[model samples]
Target: MSPTIGAIVIPVSDLESAKKVYTALYGEPHTDQPYYVGFNVNGFEVSLNPQGEGGPVAMTDVDDLDATRNALLAAGATEQSAPRTVAPDVRICVLADSDGNPFGLRGK
Candidate 1:
């Protein structure tokens, strides 16, 4: 089987609001809307699903979460949490769209 992160559908409270938040965060328009707002971030397929339809926050893996989070914020992505050390040589963090769905960032 081919194992890889393909796409995630996040449920937001509102599509328009989610669009604004995602656009500001991603710095681009969703591939499509009123259904799916898709984006490819660092090779990860991400789609913003409207509140009722969108499922949950889609988090991607990374090597340096602190640095990644810093970079994301610099790019206008909001930090849901600072880098949190979970285990030795490992940590995780979260970022969110304007509506508050939690997209996670992890490192080891």
Candidate 2:
């Protein structure tokens, strides 16, 4: 399956403070949780990840999360996290390239 970037995650050290700033910028978040805050701006999802490092992560949408993750691993990407269900049908996992550039893969 051809995957496309569906979400952008920005790492924040302070969730509450970042929420305030993001609220002011994006108006209101569509998904607000202690771990993550997400805003939909002009059809693009921008999210704040409290557990993220200092770099931004781009989440790509795939048809099969497991297969795509395995492909990435075979292509030299390292696993950062195992697949986990975040929503009812949504599954997500993290990986990093050889240079340690982190990204995510999501499916439903």
Candidate 3:
């Protein structure tokens, strides 16, 4: 078995809108394929999957979520809550982007 992520799937309300957002952020699309537009940058391989419910609330782990939270805040993301323990092995904080989709960052 592989010890790393095979890939990630992100769902979006509008494929066109998501494509534009991801393109601006990542700076390039991973593939020339027309159906999906995205690429692997940094550690994440982002793909915009068109679907109904919502995009992913990425659970990121960091040594200092307070700092990470601050960064995200400065970039226009809103803090839904401060970091708190959810389980013995989990501590997480919720955040929402300008579009109101919720995502979390966790620390061990």
Candidate 4:
């Protein structure tokens, strides 16, 4: 399957405060928890992570996580975080381009 830009996760210092602002713009979040607050903007996922470092990271949905990540690494991308499951049937990984700009990938 072709990759699709499915989600963008923003790292916030204060989740509650950020939740308020994001909720105002996007309405109430579909998923609200201590670790994350996720809003659905149209079909795209806009998420907030209290533990994340750096700025926002856009996640691309892929059919095969390992193959795609390996290919990216072969093409000069570096692994920032190895693939791990965040929720049921949902797995994600963080990677950086050669210049060290981080992005993410999500798969089932």
Candidate 5:
């Protein structure tokens, strides 16, 4: 499947503060939870991740999460987290490139 950037996740130390800022910038969020907050701006998803360790991670959508994850691993990416269901009908996996840049793969 052709890859597409599904979401851009930002690491926020303070969830409430970040949420307020994002809310002002993107208007009301479609998703609001302790672990995550999500906003849709012009069809692009922007999310705040309170547990994120460092920089933002761009989640790419794939047709098959496992297959794409395996392919990325074979192509020199290291697994950071295995695929897991985050919400109903949504699954995601995290990986890091050779330079330790984190990214994610998402699928339904």
Candidate 6:
């Protein structure tokens, strides 16, 4: 199956400032914390991460994280991070394309 974008995480130097701006555009966030703020736009998750560097990274949902990650690596994508569990059953990882643009993969 093909991967689909599930979330877009934007990097911010100042969490509070970014929160204010995003909140104004998308309304109140469903999840608010010091490290991350999340808003549900329709069914998609829009998040702010102070720890995230560079620009926004799009998180794509895949069926098999390991297989897909390996395929991407074989296709010239470099691993920025290994797959790690975020929530109870949710896992995520970061990778950069050949040109060095970062993207994310999220799965169970």
Best by TM-score: 4
Give the residue spans of candidate 4 off by over 4 A. Answer: none
Per-residue CA lDDT of model 1 for 51-70, tens digit only, reads 33434655566766677778
- The sequence of per-residue lDDT tens digits that candidate 3 reaches over residues 1-108 is 212332355767678777878888888785735455557788675666564245455656666667777899999999876887845875667789898878777654
Q: Is candidate 2 or candidate 3 better by TM-score?
A: 2
| TM-scores for every candidate against the unseen true structure | 0.44, 0.91, 0.43, 0.97, 0.94, 0.94
Question: Could you tell me how far off, in angstroms, the CA of residue 104 lies in candidate 4 after the best superposition?
Answer: 0.5
After superposition, the stretches of candidate 6 with alpha carbons farther than 4 Å from their true spots are: none
The root-mean-square deviation over C-alpha atoms between each candidate and the true structure, in angstroms, is: 11.7, 1.4, 10.3, 0.7, 1.0, 1.1
Q: For model 3, which pairs clash?
A: 30-38
Clashing pairs in 6: none
lDDT of 6 by residue, 38-99 (tens): 99999999999999888899999999998999999999999998999977878999999989
Tens-place lDDT per residue, model 2, 51-104, is 888688899999999989999999999998899998899999999999998999
lDDT (CA) per prediction: 0.65, 0.92, 0.67, 0.96, 0.92, 0.93
| Total residue pair clashes for candidate 5 | 0
| Candidate 4 residue-wise lDDT at 33 | 96
Name the runs in model 5 displaced over 4 angstroms.
Answer: none
lDDT for each residue of candidate 5 in 1-108, tens digit (9 for 90 to 100) = 699997998999999999999999889999999999999999889999899878898999999888888889999999988888989989998999999999999996
Give the top-scoring candidate (lDDT).
4
Model 2 poorest 10 in a row by lDDT: 49-58
Candidate 1 similarity to native, TM-score: 0.44
